[model samples]
Target: MKGSSKTHLRIVFTLGIIVLSIYESSSQFLNDEFCGNKEVLTLDYRKKPWKGKNQFLLDYLKKIDYKDNIDSVRFRIPVKFWIYRNDDGSGGVTDERVKVFMDSLNHFHKLNNTGFRFYIREIESVNKTKRLNLGYFVEAPLQTIFNHTKACVNIYVCDFIKKKANGATYVVRGTYNIVTKSVMLQRNTSSTGLTHEIGHYFGLLHPHRNYKSGKNKQESVSRTRAYKGSLKKGLICERNGDGLADTPAEPRLNFLVDNNCNFSGQALTDNWGDHYQSETNNIMSYPTHYKCRNNFTLSQKSVMLYKASENKYAKYWNTKDSANKIYHFDIHEPDNTVKMASIIKSNEKQNHTFHKIFTTGKKGLATDKTDWLKFELNTENTSNILIKFTPDKIVNDEITITIYDEDNKLIKTINTSKQIASSQIQLKTLKSGWYFIEINKKQSVSKKLYNYSVELIIE
Candidate 1:
């Protein structure tokens, strides 16, 4: 009997291994093929205090006229709010609460000049229905509603249940690529913690830990200490608790109020907005008071703008198939500076005019030109191209235009030796495919090039 039992056990173990192997293989295949290669950019530091010294955050805010910009764009796009409620009768978000949340978001838009509008849709009794359970099954219905809507931003809320024993939250938030049809979010939870999580959806990382602004409080004490935190050991801070650098690090004991707490010493405090000495009134912190949780700093604003202008959100403004198709191209500089330009192509085939949509720096300077450039066209037939170059003003300097096929082959080159400042040329006929257009100056002198636009017409 013992020998028979041992043989049976061995057979069961072999079958279990086979099942596990199949499951893993299937999971990998889905992740690679179904989910496109979308990456979430991470912020630099996560455990320092926000003494209001993060530079990356600051620079981002400075680039835009927030008040005017957001207001201008608000009416142009619709924002959708998804409210998930607990069906178990514990407590669901009230309509008043929803109104308050919507108000806060709208206020934020007005303050930042986001120029976006919001529309709320509440999904009640989610907890009662197993079909709506987050992660796998729930995504299907939610995606259906998302596909039909014309909103630029989709906001989802859930009463996240965190398992106390495992310390894992049940809620997840993410942005889905409608093109690739994928979902992405920073983390998941059930609390009314919509603000921070929604910020992540917009591509904003935690403020305190970005490359420009993360540092220790002691570093500001002296210039020497400034460089000290830049090194290895000094990098550690107490707020390391929440993993956000803007929130100063505090040991476990500091979470509770202690009358004996020393506010003046090197010891960190538990109070809100205490800088290196304690936690700040920042909403990014764990403080329970709502008053302390207001406002995204200038740096935070800039990061959001940059992400909105560059990443997944960028598609909102310049969607794949809009009446006017705008394509964004990045120019990488040797000094690590990036320049952006926008191109617009028409849907109809005509005389094909190329226009200068947008450019950074001086309009006429050659040195300010970008090394890398890309263009977006309306039609898929990328062949038979015509380019027109018109400078801002008449000049004797020569301009060179190069055309390349999809394979990077130099198909045609037009060099003008005459003093003509504006001209147009037709390149060798192209097949029904995509191509690249590169523009540069012929002279070596550092001169500013002005308003030059390209117009493409396909026959």
Candidate 2:
């Protein structure tokens, strides 16, 4: 009887263990079971592509209208990035430390306008299991964590380990699935890290590494070809592939490294380019220091857009405002009374007069007097005409209108001020001619007003 009782007790204990394991696995999969404290959101699809390829993925991106304009591309995908500082008191994340990190990310986003909605979440979990640690053991379980998430993409951040047993500082797993519409990022922290890993997440391969399937070791020929091709096309230098078409190629050996590890001073291609070595700066390349790591090349932007379009991750083209064609023009000097002008020629000529339309004003700071001005142009006929403006100086003010040509004049003057915020004047009566619109203000301010975009209807 005693032996039987002992056997029954062991059986009960084993059953309990099994139940716990099942619970843990289920918790990882279900969103509601996530420690009752994690934040998550299911982003909605904004626009649908006409011909379906990556329809499911493309539906989620915010549709940007660039059909009529080239300077600014519209994106529908609202990307929100949250940084969780899980450093514990034993050199783990602290509030102040996390703030610094958050600030850096914010600056980078602002500079690039990658168009991801960004936010920082500080997780203060007392449970050791929920806390994020920067070691091998902590990262080991992340693979399972990633497997559990339904996200199309999962990026894991951890500290770098240099042992042969440890993988590269960054590891990207899984291909972009057009069917499932998902991808994954497995990365380790290094001096020149996250950016590179993020690049991989977007389908960019390492400049020095061969990406053919089933290949384990990097070959010299693979590295050489990447360098030579990128250089010829001006994508990246031989030192680091910065993902630009204009910058010179950089060799992989020039990358920077921290001098404390066994791999230190081992001829790394990690350093971000300095002004002396390269003229243009890109975010994907190794940075000499933290400050230098910023910006995406135009080619990279196109590639990202293409991928998003191809994977059906999101729609980039805006088809709503079809009648009005938009165009971008940079105004060098703007002030209370300065002329912003552009020559608008039509493929087919239709007689039209000039009028006012919609304008978006500048935001932040009054240092540049020109930042306060806004203007728009319209015509009654499809004939080409030079449209010009001398805006009223009011910081961050917008003007929109539809006006008729009151008088037949080659040049017309529209007055704007604090009292009269906006006005529309028609130019249909006037014949096609070179018109001058001038705004005169104090010449002390020397900043270029960018994203000064306009849309016009020929008829």
Question: Which candidate number has the best lDDT?
Answer: 1
**Which ten contiguous residues of candidate 1 have the minimum total lDDT?**
329-338
Question: How many clashes (backbone N, Cα, C below 3 Å) per candidate?
Answer: 54, 55
- lDDT comparing candidate 1 with the true structure: 0.39
Candidates in order, TM-scores: namely 0.38, 0.34
Write model 2 residue lDDT over 1-459, tens digit each, in one string.
999998887667445433433343332222111011101111111222211123222333334422212334333221212222334433333434333333444445445655331222112222233333322222323333323222223333222211112233322221121111222222223322444434444544333222121212222222223322532321123222322323333332233423321112233222331222232245554333434456655445544555545544332222123422221212222111212222334322222111111212453212212222222344334444333332322233332322222232325454443323223444454443333333222223322221232223334
Which residue segments of model 1 deviate by more than 4 Å? Answer: 1-62, 66-78, 81-97, 109-117, 120-128, 131-152, 167-192, 206-266, 269-275, 313-459
- Please give the lDDT score at residue 32 for candidate 1: 14
Name the 10 consecutive residues with the lowest summed lDDT in model 2.
33-42
Candidate 1, residues 400-430, lDDT tens digits: the string is 7776666778877787655557777675445
**Every model's Cα RMSD, please?**
19.8, 19.7
